[model samples]
Target chain A: MNKLMVYMFKNFIRMLLLLLFVSITAFILVSLSPIDPLQANISQTALGSLSQEQIDKLEMYWGVNEAPIERYLAWVRAFLHGDMGTSLLYRQSVASVIMQKLSNSLMLMVFAWIISGGIGFFLGILSGMNRGKIIDKLIKGYALLTASAPTFWLALLFLLVFSVWLGLFPIGLSVPIGMDAASVSLSDRLQHAILPAVTLSITGISNIVLHTREKMIDVLESEYVLFAVARGEKRWEIFRHHGLRNILLPAITLQFASISEIFGGSILVEQVFSYPGLGQAVVTAGLGGDIPLLLGITVISAAIVFAGNFIADILYGIVDPRIRKGARS
Target chain B: MDRIPILDIQNLSVSFSQYVDMFRKNDLQVIKDLNLKLFEGEVVAVVGASGSGKSLLAHAILGILPYNASFSGRMSYCGEPLTQMRIEQLRGKEIVLVPQSVSYLDPLMKVGFQIRKSVNDKRSKEKMLQTLNRYGLGEEVEKLYPFELSGGMARRVLISTAVMDSPRLVIADEPTPGIHIDAAKQVLGHFRKIADDGAAVLIITHDLELAIEAADRVVVFYAGMTLEEAQASDFSDESKLSHPYTRALWRAMPQNGFRAIESIKEADL
Candidate 1:
């Protein structure tokens, strides 16, 4: 128990450092970008109509008049006190906007994650067990092709085929247009999420499949597996007794690590589908130069990705005693 | 000695199909005309240099040879033809292999559960404990994983796993490499005990001296063929050994002046 606490505490320190680095980089990059918030947020006509006094007030309010380091420090001070500030474009608290959008993104991401992991794990084991056969070739070819394919492009293709061509699903968005948020049914939300989730899952599936397949092939070729085979263990028995536990640890690690990929892919997927999730909000906040909103999303996403990796680390100790012993020592 | 040997291999040959060129393939024979018999209550060691098809012979008997390899031989287990299907049925139970190293034990599995395989009944657990105890391994060792075991403990665990089913034929392939001399002898001593308890033990190793010490009979192999078959007592004197290669091996022993033969080929011998 003491060892576990130490391990977790170390990981917590590492996560804090990573998050700090990510936030600083995001802040610097956003500050240096060419997008002028005054122009990007307001039209030329609206800017021209404003008097010098009104323009000065707007610039001061947006902290455009402040030095980059001063503005960053001020934002950090506010952030530490649970004050994420307001989204200039949304005219709402950045924290509330994030909370609203994050729920939807989590639903989409979790759905895709489970689907991709389930199908990919099964296919990986299948292809690895039947290596060099036609099924293996087919799965390998699919993984190769999909791994190189871009998420936005796949999302567009799904939108075209499943929405425009077949008319089987919505073209975009988390809820039906013109429907009240309180009135929307679970089935309706599920229907709207299907295409986006499917697109994200398809792109995510390739990595997990390839990694798991390689691990499976490695396990099958190991000396212990050969010993199991020589001991009169049949195919199913070998997989159940020897193969599964060996492959499962790596599979779980890959599955959790892929969370970052899934989140990144969700951004492009959300754009193509115009889904009103955290991914779409990131795009909106970035374009509108809503620094507070952008930074909040950045910190949260980084935390999530780090958490995914941390979970994988903990699970390694649980699944394999060898690693557990190493960690304890 | 039993009238029918536990395992008999006659005129055995093994070859693998390999692609020599882009479009051409050929069969490369690795073992030829190898013959040996392992009777009940005896330990027979097949001693040879590495890659002399000693391990291949073990794989052959267990029907675990590589897919591309082909063999022509007549192998019988207790007077019955040991066909592929028959070996498969008897594998892990009536017949078992004590693999070369602890690496042959599943790294992810507990030592006790691994030996029992899927038999989780209370009685099977008791038997597994008994088997471990027989190998001087305590019940506490059962809960440990393979990596947690020391070199000697790992070796004992392998031996325990093999004898858990009370197999009639036990084939050990290079069971004591990279271990201390004392520990190796202790491991070999376990095999001697297994044989004394009425199981036929076939040990494949490169250490001729160790083989002679533990085995009742030793078969000398050279370039995939059995060069000589002699009683372990015969190694005490060069004259008692028939083949020149076998006699050269005797002279090469450290106890006997450690004579260095310039070459091991038949002509040189």
Candidate 2:
């Protein structure tokens, strides 16, 4: 229990550090970028032809005149209390906008991760067990191809193949055949999300397959397997028990990072398919220079990434003794 | 006694080959017709210069030989064909190896974990500690890693792991090398108790005096073949030896208890 307490305290410190690093870096980076947030906003709004006085008033109103540190601190302070201010273009509270689209992104990402992780784990185990066999060769070839291919390009190509050429599904929208959002079934929602999810899953599956395979190879060569085999343990039991436990540890940790990526990285798929998601909100806000919304999404994305990695470390500590020993909370 | 040895070998040849050319491979023959045997419950020691296949015979019997080594002819364990048995099954539960150095174990594993690993039961943790205590290794040795253990303690722990599983045959390779004689004797004494428990122990070493004092029977090896086989009592009467190599090795041990021989001398003795 004392050890658990120490671990928790250390984890809290790490969480704070991750938040600090992400927010500060994001703040500094956006502040330094050449794009004029005011101009970027004016061009997209009725305020484009306004006087310099109105622009000054707008800058003062938005607290853009404040120091970057002060602005960042104020933003963080507001975010902690669930107040992310309002977008200049959309004129909606950042939180409300995020909540509106969070579900779509979640639906796409969760299913993507499940599909990728499940398939990757099975294929990895298969390949590792049959190292030089035909299945191993096929898995290796597939993993290599998917990992090297750009995800955004894959999303575009998939849109062409599945939505355009086949006419099997709608191309750029989450609804089927102009159906009202209020009447859409859960099955329809999942069907609409499938292409995007597949788009998101390709590289993720590749990463998991590659990592699990490498770890399995290492585990299979370990002395414990030899010892286990000496005990009359069947070959499949070695794969299922000792081999799986050791290799899955690293894969489990990777699972969290993949989760964060799916959530934060579904932007292109959402855009190409016109799926209303937090990713779409962020992309629109970023390009249109909606300061509050962009800053809010950036901060949230960073937080989610930080949270995913933190959870991974803790979960990994539980699974792997090597980590559990040295990796304190 | 039955005429058939507990472990018998006839023309047991082994080799390793590597691809040296596009259409050809080079073969390295490590052991040639290495005929030898050990009896049940006997503490038999094999001693020679390094690379004389003292370790290879143990590997061949246990079927833990490197992938390259192609072995031929019969090598049996209690009249059972060794080559045919699953290599992994023969280890720990059947034939355990007390390796030359204790560092051979996975360094990441705890001493107790390695001990438990040999027995294949997670409850082997508590059981191993109790078994270690029976062999005179106390409780503190359990939590420590292999690096933290004293040379003597490490050796004893290796033996503790070996016998924890109660194997029928324990092939120990130089169980007491590079340690002081006092520690060596202490370890050898432990080996004797293990042999007394009705297990066949094949010890490979060059320490003639240690072998004479500890082993019930000694099989001497030179250049990958058995040179001589004799009972421990037969050593008192030196004329009973058959092989020139065995006679030379026996003559090489210094008469003084602690003092080792200065050098081995012979013009083909």
Model 1: per-residue Cα lDDT over B1-269, one tens digit each: 54998999999999989999999889988889999999999999999999888899989999999889999989999999999999999999989999988888889888888888867999889999898888888899989988899888988888888888888999999999889989999999999888888899999999999999999999999888888999998888888988888887888889998999557566743
For model 2, what is the error of residue A179's alpha carbon versus the real structure, in angstroms, after optimal superposition?
A: 4.1
Write the residue-wise lDDT of candidate 2 on A241-303 in tens digits: 567766776787888888776775588778878888888988887676566788777777777
Off by over 4 Å in 1: A326-329, B18-27, B180-182
**For residues A36-151, could you state the per-residue lDDT of candidate 1 as single tens digits?**
88988889999999999999998877778789999889888998898988888889999999999999999999999999999999999999989999999999999989999988
User: What are the per-residue Cα lDDT tens digits for candidate 2 across B57-80?
Assistant: 666776666667778887676776
- What DockQ does predicted model 2 obtain? 0.27
Interface RMSD per candidate (angstroms): 0.9, 4.4
TM-score for chain A in each prediction: 0.97, 0.87
Alpha-carbon lDDT, every model:
0.90, 0.75
